[model samples]
Target: MNTPIDLRSDTVTLPTRAMREAMYHAELGDDVYGEDPTVNALEAQAAAMLGHEAALFVVSGTMGNLVAILTHCGRGDEAIMGDECHTFHYEVGGAAALGGVPIRTVPNGHDGLPALADIEAAIRPDDIHDPPTRLLCLENTHNRCGGTAIGPEPFRAACDLAHRHGVAVHLDGARIFNAAIARGCPVRELVAPADTVMFCLSKGLGAPVGSLLAGPADFITRARKNRKMVGGAMRQVGVLAAAGLVALDQMVDRLAEDHEHAQLLAHGLAAIPGVHIDPSRVHTNIVIFEVTDPLAFLQRLQAEGVLGVYFGGQMVRLVTHYGITRADIEATLVTVRQALRAA
Candidate 1:
């Protein structure tokens, strides 16, 4: 049997040999006591990279977002977010369920930006009947929006609107590095406007686990309490943080390679009959394209040792990552072509 080309997501990426070795020798202590040097280093690095005063390591991206939400908003407060964003659509309503935070949804444009006017209109006035809007959420390299990179200008404008209205902004930047690479800027520039940001080391960075929630030191201090209340405090977490440090040091610059492979895959898929994609819209590693029947198309590809995931409707999502090479993209294209013929 041949190796399967798993294009389901960048989260499928395995830890590198360096990461494994780092984990093996990582100096460990109790993270719950804030004594884990490796975890502390990872948090400090992530905070500085995002231009924040502090950061907290969490179990997953979802947990990071939840902690940010709980820290920023009290019970019965509302959060504004893109309807199609990861927090609203994919986070299982953790904000509402766990934190008693209600969500206000604004339409996300095709480019992954919520219209400034829509965002402004969503903020609740001093009404006795309406829940106060406490937070504004944004996503970069938006998952449902063909991994589009929301540029700095639009991002700043949105955050500015939220800030003026007394609402803090929280960015669900699970793929912020990809957005930074696509826009040819530093990650700090992309994240500077956000009051809080949650980024995943387990995503495109290729770590096995852990995400960071970054903000002001005071905000993170509060979030740390919320994290413990939610049972996210862990001991000896330096083993995972060690890999995260390696990811930050070694994996960021190489994201451009994943972007290149995504473009190659998108262009090839666009040329294949029955595949529907605009290669120009593929800005980063995620390529979302349409097909006649996504499940059947994905099944055929899976049968041929090529794997991708069927998103809702006619959408199929393919993500390029560290382990997937240029050769793998070429092979995947060939396999997809054959699958189309078989259909």
Candidate 2:
């Protein structure tokens, strides 16, 4: 039987051969004691690449974001974020549950940024009754916003406004590499303005698992302790860190291929009757389209050996990753058209 074309998410990507080899030969030591040479190297490389003073390797993007939030905010503090961001919509309220942090939501624009004015307004006043606003969270290549890439200018503007109000900005940059590729800019520039950033190596980068949180050395020092509090401290985890290193070295530039595949899928799907999407709005590897009967469409695609996930209501989300090729995109388009007709 042929392999199914899976477009559910980039997280489903398997590690590369190089990653496997590196993991096998990786130097191992107690990471909790800061003795894992490979983990230390990965952390150092990630910090240097993203232009930060230090970085902490975490188990996943969710944990990375949680640790960052815990480091930046105290009990009863508030964090402002876009309503459509992963931190607000997807994360299981770890900030509130574990850290006693309250979330303040602002509208996310189609371009995947909360308006500067809305963010400014969301900041809590210096009143005894209100929770002090401590952090502003942003998502690049925002998931719910159809993977729109937020460029550096708007990112810088938002960070500046938040900082002026004495609030630190934390970026949920799970797909920061994709955004960098889509914007044709350096990843350092895209991440420069934020006080903290959490990026997933398991996503588009195709590592088996791992995420990194980067920030000032002091912030990371505190985040490391927070990670331990959250039960995220690991031992001899350099095997996974080796894969992340390979991902960083080999997988960053090829994100352009996934972006192009998304364009192809978006344009083709838009041409089908009763399917709605704007190909021009597709900026990265994620493609979202509306169908008249999303359930039936998904069922048909499953039967046809094409896999994707529903994004609530009539929306379906497809993500192209490291192994998805032009052929896969072409086959997926054919399956989508057929499924729509059958539905």
| Candidate that would win on lDDT | 1
What shift in Å separates residue 212 of candidate 2 from its native position after superposition? Answer: 0.2
lDDT of 2 by residue, 1-343 (tens): 5889999999999999999999999999999999999999999999999999999999999999999999999999999999998988878999999999999999999999999989999998999999999999999989999999999899999999999999999999999989998998899999999999999999999999999999999999999999999899999999999999999999999999999899989998888898999988899999999998888889899898999999999999999998898999999999988887776
- The TM-score, computed over Cα atoms with residue i paired to residue i, of candidate 1 is 0.99
Q: Give stretches of model 1 more than 4 Å off.
A: none
Q: Report the number of backbone clashes for model 1.
A: 0
Q: Over 4 Å off in model 2, which ranges?
A: none
Clashing pairs in 1: none
lDDT of 1 at 245: 100
C-alpha lDDT values of all predictions = 0.95, 0.94
TM-score of each: 0.99, 0.99
